[model samples]
Target: MEMQVWASLFGVILGGLLSYLAQFTTVRLAARNEEKRQAAQRAEARRSERLELLREFIAITQAGIRIAEERDQAPDWDAAGTPEWFAAARNIIDRLWVAERMIEVLFSPQMYQLARAYASAVDHVLWRLPEQIAAEGSMWDHLRGPQHEFLAGARTDVGSLP
Candidate 1:
């Protein structure tokens, strides 16, 4: 009877120890999985935000290009300070400003440098041709390569359109 009691106690202690170990392992795995899941979620959120910013930046750049094109094609655009001409000029400037700010806010440092280079190209054209319009053909040509590289690197759907 004493031997039987000893055997039962041994079995009970072993069972308790096994149960505790199993529970501990399960809790540890669960915590690890939760951490991994949260990390993935944060990475996804950052990717989404970056995509949105890229879209906005590209859209603003496109708008600025279109405005410049329209101004180039306009008749009597040489008549500086005329209401219509002034409005187009203002629109182009405003859109470029917005693009610059977008790059500043959304771009990584290296990306910002590349984008700023593009913007600087545009600025140079604008400064040189303050009163002229279609003269920016060279500027657009210069931007095409860098713009394509930027878009490709970013993996964004925004295309580099002249």
Candidate 2:
């Protein structure tokens, strides 16, 4: 009877230890999975934010390019200095300044540099419009290289996200 009691006690103890280990492992795995899920959510949120920022910045840049193109095509250089023209140009520059600052804050150093170059190219063209000096080609040509470089950099930056 004593032997029977000892054997039963050993079996019960071993079973309880195994049950505890299983529960511990399950809880750890669940916690790890939760952490991974939350990390993925955060990454996705960041990617979305970057995409919106790029979209807004690109739209503003295009608007600036259009204004520069119109100025380039204008026949009357005197009209370029009108208050209305200055107001429009000022508005574009203000928006571009904001966009540039946002890019500088949110993006990598290389991305910010690329954005700055593109913005500067556009600004140069706009400022040159009032002088009536024709470049060898369209003023938009000045923006093409910097725009392409910035776009490529943006694509790379966005695509690298998880």
TM-score to native of every candidate shown: 0.72, 0.87
lDDT of each: 0.65, 0.87
Task: Report RMSD for candidate 1.
Answer: 4.9
Off by over 4 Å in 1: 80-107, 123-137, 156-162
lDDT of 2 at 38: 100
Cα lDDT, model 2, residue 125: 81
Q: Which residue pairs collide in model 1, if any?
A: none
